[model samples]
Target: MSGILRFLLSGLAVLLTSYLLNGVHVRDYWYALLVAAVLSLANVIVRPVLIFFTIPITFITLGLFLLVINALIILLVDFLVPGFNVDGFWWALAFSLILAIFNSLFDDITGEKAKRNQD
Candidate 1:
């Protein structure tokens, strides 16, 4: 199903992103899968709270502060996940940006067919 495909693609993105960044390390494919799942959960649960609390700064920065929130989420995941590691805040920021790009690319690849079917 598309849900399973999306999950797998997300894991692939994580693995690929880790490979692309020197400061990011993922132990293996399985860990990448775990990282993807945790990252999704963090985005769902933690991200909203962060956005709510930092609304003023987020607004002041013209939405750039969301990148900081993304980095913080990566750092939090690095703390919670054993096999996935981000070297530091800078590394976390780089990892997050790269991951977002990968995720978007993968999503477009997978989503195009679904959109065609829907149309």
Candidate 2:
């Protein structure tokens, strides 16, 4: 139940982020949901591998490289999902940052983070 709520919130975040960013385009609410699911899967499956491989660079950049990895994940989602488009790497980066902010805000509002910490 919580997982489903989280998924819906994530989709909302995607839609809102794309609406705010001129360079990011989401075809509709359904596409936003699809993007959210694909993005979550990429973060779960691909992010760790990317972090492991880029440890040296991540360290050298004082963790800033994680942002690049996040942008790359956005690009990967753009490629895999139809009706979702990011203008370029810069746009993808902006989209990622904004989406993260929205997700964080949603989590806080829903007390999801508090529940997670208790668990």
**TM per candidate:** 0.93, 0.98
Q: What number of clashing residue pairs does each candidate have, in the order they appear?
A: 0, 0
Tell me the tens digit of each residue's lDDT in model 1 across 1-119.
Answer: 87888889889999999999889999999999999999999999999999999999999999999999999999999999999999999999999998888877877777755676788
lDDT of 2 by residue, 6-103 (tens): 99999999999999999999999999999999999999999999999999999999999999999999999999999999999999999999999999
Q: Lowest-lDDT window of 10 residues in candidate 1? A: 107-116
Model 1's lDDT to the true fold?
0.92
The CA lDDT of each predicted structure is: 0.92, 0.97
C-alpha lDDT of candidate 2 relative to the true structure: 0.97
